[model samples]
Target: MQTYEIWDSEYRFMTIVWDNAPIGSGALCTLCLQQLGWKKSTVYNAIRKMCEKGLIQNENATVRVLVPREQVQREESDAFLRRTFSGSLPGFLNAFLSGRTLSEKEAEELKKLIDAHRKEG
Candidate 1:
């Protein structure tokens, strides 16, 4: 399996691209500058590096996603589960919600999500 690891800066950059893709490189520079305080050169460098990494595409000076945001989120969460909780969802949840009280709605929503993703034998 290919790793979809991204640094914090790259992840922030990718979130922007995911939100507003097929955006002109110049427009991207503007948005990055406004939102991330990144200059044009910084934006261009990110575009170049991410393009080389097959995470995004730059065609006709317009940028688009090559990897969907959900895929990256899933990979990132899976990696976290592996690294921090030894891939144990229950363990992770136990630690995360140790002192927190879940509302009925929240508990029901989590149950629904678990049911939806559960594998059928």
Candidate 2:
């Protein structure tokens, strides 16, 4: 998969935009200030940078998402899985659940998800 590398701060900024897209740039700045405590300059800077990255678009002083949130999550999750667990899902799950316990309901949900994927693939 091609990398759509986004920094942590940029991801946070995008989260707000995703939550309230087709938003005016000024409205976006206000939300960033209220939620992320970012100034207008900072908001505009991110808008400019992400627009150039094709992650977002800002036209006519309005901002919109080009990349959906789920796509970014998938890309980041895949990268992390490869880099940290050598693309091993079981290895990742083993480490993640080492000191934890799942309730019956949780386990059933996971089983259903895995079963569903197995059927799909």
Candidate 3:
């Protein structure tokens, strides 16, 4: 598995590419300018950096994602849990739910998911 550490700006840039992939590089620049307020050079620089990180590909002036967004999200979530909660899912959930109430339906759904994933032994 290839783990990528994407910063906030880089993730934003990748989100754009993921949403509209196989887009022309010039069009990407225009989208970045309109959405992110970035210049053409900034868009090109970000593309080059992402390509170097194996997160995206720019081929024949068309851009596409090399790594799917879900993989990066999963990796980022795992890393956050490990760093902030010492890899304890309960600890992370407790902190996340502090002062926040889940809807009854949402709670029930979460319970069902936990039950489905529970250990048998």
lDDT of 3: 0.85
- Sorting all predicted structures by lDDT, with the top scorer first, yields 3, 2, 1
For TM-score, the strongest prediction is: 3
lDDT of 1 by residue, 24-83 (tens): 999999999999999999999999988988999999999999888766642344543344
Which regions in candidate 1 have their CA more than 4 angstroms from the true location?
1-3, 73-121
User: In terms of TM-score, which candidate is stronger, 2 or 3?
Assistant: 3
Report the C-alpha lDDT of model 2 over 72-91, residue by residue, as the tens digit.
74235454334467768887
Give candidate 2 regions above 4 Å deviation. Answer: 1-3, 73-121
Which residue pairs show collisions in model 2?
none
Candidate 3 lDDT over residue span 29-79, tens digit each:
999999999999999999999999888989999998889987774235454
- Candidate 1 local Cα displacement, residue 51, angstroms: 0.6
Model 1 poorest ten-residue lDDT run: 73-82
Candidate models: Cα lDDT each:
0.84, 0.84, 0.85
Please give the lDDT score for candidate 2. Answer: 0.84
